[model samples]
Target chain A: MRFTIQRDQLMNSVQDVMKAISSRTTIPILTGMKVEATEYGVKLTGSDSDVTIESFIPVEEDGIVLVENIEPGSIVLQAKYFPDIVKKLPQQTVEIEVDDHFNVNIRSGSAEFHLNGQDAEEYPHLPQIQTNQSFEVPIDLLKDLIRQTVFAVSTSETRPILTGVNMKVESDDLYFIATDSHRLASRKIPMGGNVQPLSFENVVIPGKSLTELNKILDDSQETIEISVTENQILFRTKHLYFLSRLLDGNYPETSRLIPDEVKTTVYIDTKELLQSIDRASLLAKENRNSVVKLTTKENNRVEITSNSPEVGNVVEEVTAESLEGEDLKISFSAKYMMDALKVVDCEKVNIQFTGAMRPFLIRPNENDQILQLILPVRTY
Target chain B: MRFTIQRDQLMNSVQDVMKAISSRTTIPILTGMKVEATEYGVKLTGSDSDVTIESFIPVEEDGIVLVENIEPGSIVLQAKYFPDIVKKLPQQTVEIEVDDHFNVNIRSGSAEFHLNGQDAEEYPHLPQIQTNQSFEVPIDLLKDLIRQTVFAVSTSETRPILTGVNMKVESDDLYFIATDSHRLASRKIPMGGNVQPLSFENVVIPGKSLTELNKILDDSQETIEISVTENQILFRTKHLYFLSRLLDGNYPETSRLIPDEVKTTVYIDTKELLQSIDRASLLAKENRNSVVKLTTKENNRVEITSNSPEVGNVVEEVTAESLEGEDLKISFSAKYMMDALKVVDCEKVNIQFTGAMRPFLIRPNENDQILQLILPVRTY
Candidate 1:
């Protein structure tokens, strides 16, 4: 493989592909990144079993040449130092050549590096998802969907199925939900498309995969085509391809976890409540779960407090916009509450509580598309 | 104890004192910070046996009331959560009150915290340094002096003395030197005024202590008074007192390690040389010390090359301002060379090499105050 490429373009592609590369892969060849030079452009691929990322640089685009002098071939170079070497090369352009013996030579300015590369044939191939079940979503909306629900996924290994976000589509509506038994996050978006009778469910994506994919994606107006099969899903953009394996199990039904009746409802400024709980959690962090209590007070006021036997106790009074129904007191993980509040991104939030023990729901006062539910801790 | 202090001022003092507080201290009281409110101001102190840092906030400094309502008393609170609480307080002013039973109440805005406190009488007292050997040095200059030589201190605990920097003053010259048996960095500054007949050669300060002190000292033109005694050295600023125990044992003689005779001389841009070696060391980092070989090429060019059997080889040619004497080849740790180059804040640096196996010296072309010496590694 012989190709001369612009250093900045190559660096960007390398970084994008590197998001899927992990050093702990059991397959030795998977530790390397496969580089192929074709008549069209240069393609770089990095994978670690669960997720595979491929980035392509076009030979010429929009009156600019990103890659040139292509002699079609392929070689796999160790991903360990390849990215750093390409980033630190002291020239605007870099030339990479691989001989028949897989000896890779990279030259830029007055620096030349000769690395031992393995034949690209040894690298595992990414499974092809040839299903016609595909849909398009705006990149920014997709990122927001991932961010809103992914954090609620279970991090514990006891329940492997809860470690992924369940994505479901029904006709013209898309829904995403993640719950770790104690807390749940759900989001739904209307997909106005030509579909009249199309529905697919049970597509669970690993939270880690979504996190990495979210980081690799730029906030743009471009639409990403998502194709899903029984065991795999592919996210395809203009010059990038991201593939992640689907979890092989049924996702639990979480709709029943969110309480229906609102025995008590409170409206408060999001920032004020967030800051009050944040201060109360400072002492609460002395405990394991960082538990903090919220109690309704007189005159449309709420008290957020936390106590630790060895540390101390903190109480913060935050004035609420309005409080209705019977007065309520509840205790929950401060971390969970903070995480839920961060994604609301609104001036005011409405919190509904069925009782102190039942799970409560919080949503942006302006929109009901995003909802967060947290199960209160019993602190009698 | 009772006092209301400005949050920003209290936060700054808490951070300064936190530098000396370590959770691993054997003494239980050392894990707490002692706060004493006097008629004048509030003083905060934290210690971990080896080092103690104290910061004072005057009741009224320059007509600005930093602290008010100060009732003379003292108490020790756990340092683990105190700093975080102070930083996240929900008001500009904070009120701290300690009851008769040693329960501390910290109130700000509508938030209140009740913490368990220990009697201040149990806190370790900072030793008094009543020596007449005291001198003043500009804070910026002192920070610079510490940074120029501290990185060369030996991290290995086998030679405890090498883990500290040797500080010597003679007549009107002050010198600082540190070495780890392989590389050495030395800096000297001429002291003007009242130092015509004073000398102290046995003072050694631990590198770790200097690093912490350097972090706490702001880059200002104000002078700091440093006093030395038999066992401890005290650094006193207008509002802070930092005391560190001196490292015992005689420091190794490192003056002879730097070669006086120069058989080869090369002058090059510091940045160019640093970037070239940084690129060459990409593959070299896979090895132990990230060793890179530098050889003088024809036409005043220096070739930096590093090789790893599994990773490959990199060679970079950097043009030098001038190369004199016979052509030479030397191998040294790229890390050591980078550390030395980072401290030389000059465009041009002169490197002096005596032989392939002898130690070499590097210095800025314009100044002789700071010098770095590195020993060559035998590759054969």
Candidate 2:
């Protein structure tokens, strides 16, 4: 392969593909990135068994020539140092050439690098997801959906299916749900005539895959097409392609985990409650899980307290906007509460409690699109 | 002890003293910070046996009341959570009260923290360090001197004394030198009229202590007094006091390591040389020390190259402004060269080489206050 491309454009594409490459891959060839140059443009592919990423740099963009002097060929170069070499190249334009024996030569200005390249034929082919079960969504909205529910997934491998986020579509509504047996987070949005009526019961995606995809995606209003098949899913944009494997088992039913009857409800400023819990958890961190207790008081006030036998205790009083129903007391992990509060970008939030041991519900006072639930700890 | 202090003022003083407290200290009391409230101000002290730092917040500064309602007493609180607590206090002013039994209550706004405090008498006493040999130097200049030479200190414990920087004072000049048997860095400055004509030859300060001290001192024009004794050294500012123990042993003779004879000299832009070597070392990093080779060519050009048998090689040619005397080729650690180049903040640098096997010298073309020496490696 022989081609010359702009340094900045090549750097960006290399970085995007590198997100899918893992250094711990057992297969030697999978540790390298495949580069192909054709009449259309240059494409780079990286995969780590579970996820594959491909990025393309066109020959010309917006009437500006980005690549020139192309010779159609393919080669795989070690992904370890390829990105660093491309980023630190000493010129505005870089020329890459591969000989028949797969010896890659990269030249820019007064610097030249010769890297050993592996045979591109040894690379495993990316699974093709050829299905009409696809939908279009704005990139920004997709990123938001991933952030709102992915963190609630189980990090342990005890239940492998619980490590992924479950996506369910019915009629014109789409929902994403994730639960780790202790807490659950669910978000729903309307399809708005863009997608046909479709239903998928068990479409579980690994939480790690979504986290990496979210990081690679830019916050733009541009739309991306997501296509789903039996065992794989593909997210395709203008010049990028992301493919991830689906979990093998069905996700657990999480609807029953959220409590229905609310014995007490309290409305408070989100920022004030977050700060109070943060301070109360300082002494609690001496223990393993860092748990804090919340008790409703008279005159629309709540007390947050945490105690450790070795290191004393802390108490914080936060004034609530309003309170109704029966007074309640609950104790839960401070980390879980803080994680739920961080995603609720609203001035006020309402928390409803059913009992001391049941999972409580927390949602924005003004919106019902997102709901977060946390199971309380038994301190008595 | 009882007092109310400005939150911002207390936070700054706590952070400064916490730098001297180490979490892994063997002594139990050393894990706590000693806080004393006097008629004049409030003082915070933290020590880890090797080094001690104290910060004082005066009752008033520049017409602003930093502290008030002070009842004279002292107590020691666990240093692990003190800084975080002070930073996250919920009010403009914080009140701290310690009962006679050493139970501390810290209140701010609607939040209160009750911490288990130890008696101040149990804390170790800081060394007095009474000596007539004292000198004053500008804080900015002292910080600069530490930065230029500290990185060259030997990290291995084979020669315990080599882990420290040797400081020697003679007549009106002070010199600092450090080496790890391979590379050496030295910086010198003239003591102004504020210091008497006193000389100390055995004052060796640990490199780690100097690094921490440099980070705590701000870049200001005000001078700080440094006093030296048989076993300890004290650095006293207007509102802070830092004490560190001196390393005991004779320092190696480093003057002879820098060769006086020069067979070849080259002048080049510091930035260009640094970037070229950085790129050349990418492949060399596979090995431990990351060594790169430099060879002088015709037409005032230098070639930087590194080769690995498994992974190919890289070569970069940098043009020098002037090359004189004999031609030369030398190999050295890229990290050592980069460390020296980073500290020499000059447009141009001059490198003098005696031979391929002997040591070489590098210094800024504009001044001679700092000098760096590196020993070349044998390629054959």
Per-model B-chain TM-score = 0.98, 0.98
Off by over 4 Å in 2: B192-196
Worst 10 residues of 1 chain A by lDDT: A193-202
How far residue B123's Cα lies from its native spot in candidate 1, in Å, is 0.8
Write one digit per residue (lDDT tens) for candidate 1, span B1-380: 89999999999999999999999999999999999999989999999989999999999888899999889999999999899999988899999999998999999999999999999999877787787778888999899899999999999999999999999876577888989999999988899864444345668899999999999999999999988887788999999999999999988778768777899999999999999989988996656589999999999999999999889999889999999988899999999999999998799999999989999999999999999999989997
Q: Write the per-residue lDDT of candidate 1 for residues A41-97, one digit (tens) a residue.
A: 999999999999999999998999999888999999999999999999999999999
Give the number of the best model, judged by lDDT.
1
Docking class of 2: high
DockQ of each: 0.88, 0.88
**Positional deviation of residue B375's Cα in model 2 after best superposition, in angstroms:** 0.9
**How much is B80 displaced in model 1, in angstroms?**
0.1
